[model samples]
Target: MHLKLIYSKKELYFLKSVFLSKVEHGGASQLCYAKHCKDVLDFSASLNPYPPDISWIPDMKLLLEYPDDSYYNLKKAIANTFGCPPEAVCVGNGSIEVIRTYFYATIEKNDFVRIDPHTFGEYSLSVQLAGGRCTVLDDVDSRVRIICNPNNPTGSILSSSELIEIARSLEESGKLLFIDEAFIDLADERQSMINKGISNVFVSRSLTKSFAVPGLRIGFGVGNPELIEKMEVIRPPWSVNAFAEDFAIKALENLDLLEKSCELIKKEKIWLYEQFERIGINYVPSAANYILLNIGADASLFSKKMLDKNIFVRDCTSFGLPRSIRVAVRTREENLILVEALEKCFQ
Candidate 1:
């Protein structure tokens, strides 16, 4: 040895893997480059095109004071929204935060988790950071399983019955289940497993996508009271900001409004699919607001060209599909703009 090492080999390897993992997300970063381009359309982030009317102004006077750490009202609102008890709820800055907090609260050294291969990257990173090993391949022996319903970059959804069966099996084995339903509201609320009376399952959901306000960043998790309490302990005090909390609480009060938002997105998705077919583009059948397209070209280059034309789309390389892109279903006019841009790019 030339010299004594300052770090262990295992630590160095783990850090290297973390450094190389893809952490890129859509929507926000692309806005910076689009400032110079007019009429830029960001189709990268999946959000409802017809969010319910929200007209609440934050109390600026309350900015001087800290929010109630207990978040009693917010929890109650979430419980009512999801048909769960308040004691079963845990709130976080966002669904991603709730997910990470759940992993940290439950995972231990040498614990292994299984995750869906074509889903969110945060699940794997969060598991690793929590000192748990994770694998994408199906392993009956894996102690925990994580999945994203209406999965990202693919938009495929499993029915509630399918998920219930899986949860039952996991429970039989004394294993854990974590489900991410961030896109469930935008897809089919009937497919939700939120109130399924399952003890071993924890479900995390977000209002960011459904409310079309990712900037607000409010999300929650529901589980058995014991597990939810554990997550609450790990959740930072006042993780949800005062403004977001207020918006979430009020939004939950009018959950029925999401039905219209869902119906509109479903219709828009069909129209977009027809346009894709007309252009000879291959697309995945999606139940959510976003659809995955097989462009038969380099995803990075295609995404860059689309952005150059004031249209931004999510390149699926981060989701491990290098030749595909994910485009969010927006309003009719906006979707028509996207179709025009697609025709131009392909031709």
Candidate 2:
């Protein structure tokens, strides 16, 4: 028997539009690539290719017990790592979840949320889904502003003092400033606003990229105690699993490895840029671990061609860049493979 669902015109239109909307993201879509290619190299996702040595095995006791709903231990670890008071720390399943929860806690219906073009797409989607309107940075009427430091796709970054100035202005006007520092660790930690004691500014940090545990999905936010509490109220209990918290706690213990990885990425990034120069491809200078290359062709087609060579790179069309693609800093051997594959695309 077929059951027909009846809905008003407005409701039906909303449902249809939401269903039809495309969600674009970059990463090793292993299942999608496995069907068409063999021995695929993933340069699409910007993660620490040389991650700290950590065992995947989970403790049996933690596995059996339900995660702490408050995320007390995880929050403490993040606070200590960033030198912030534990009261100001909020842990989540990932930085994206933390961003969404912030919106849920702070954004009112019909409020104006400001975002920069070429930033992460999820910010706009989150605002629209919460019945808030999105505007660009130039819009002075926005009640909230979200900036991705070392922004995705472009890899441009703003200094800590510059961010503080923006935050101060917004605070004076009774507005909120949210900084997405997902890639900041790959750059400079000194530029982070996490432990700055800024009242109106909220900083979201991702453990997935720096810690190389995207599958585990751990992230955290630092802000005013009151704001952190508000987000916690709306966040689902035990959203961060037991294994993820324990894993993150362990990762934090090894700061030396994280530092070593950052130094290596810096060195490799310079080398990658030099390669791009020698190849005569236009590329954006980046402080983060990724670079954007203007391939002077259809980016989607170029990505597919590279995939045919068992190499994967991010198509920048989703970030409103149709002629460019983004690639991550990897080991020298892996990067040589990418360079060879990229050169073929020009042929």
- Winning model by lDDT: 1
lDDT of 1 by residue, 173-254 (tens): 8999999999998888898999899899999999999988888999899998998898889888888898898888988887
Candidate 1 ranges beyond 4 A from true positions: 1-22, 31-39
Clash counts for the predictions, in order:
0, 0
Model 2 misplaced regions, further than 4 Å: 1-22, 30-34, 54-57
Worst 10 residues of 1 by lDDT: 28-37
Pairs in steric clash, model 1: none
The per-model lDDT (C-alpha) reads 0.87, 0.86
What is the Cα-based lDDT of residue 343 in candidate 1? 93
lDDT score for candidate 1 against the true structure: 0.87
TM-score of each: 0.93, 0.93
The CA lDDT at 144 in model 2 is 90
Q: Could you report the Cα RMSD, in angstroms, for every candidate shown?
A: 2.9, 2.5
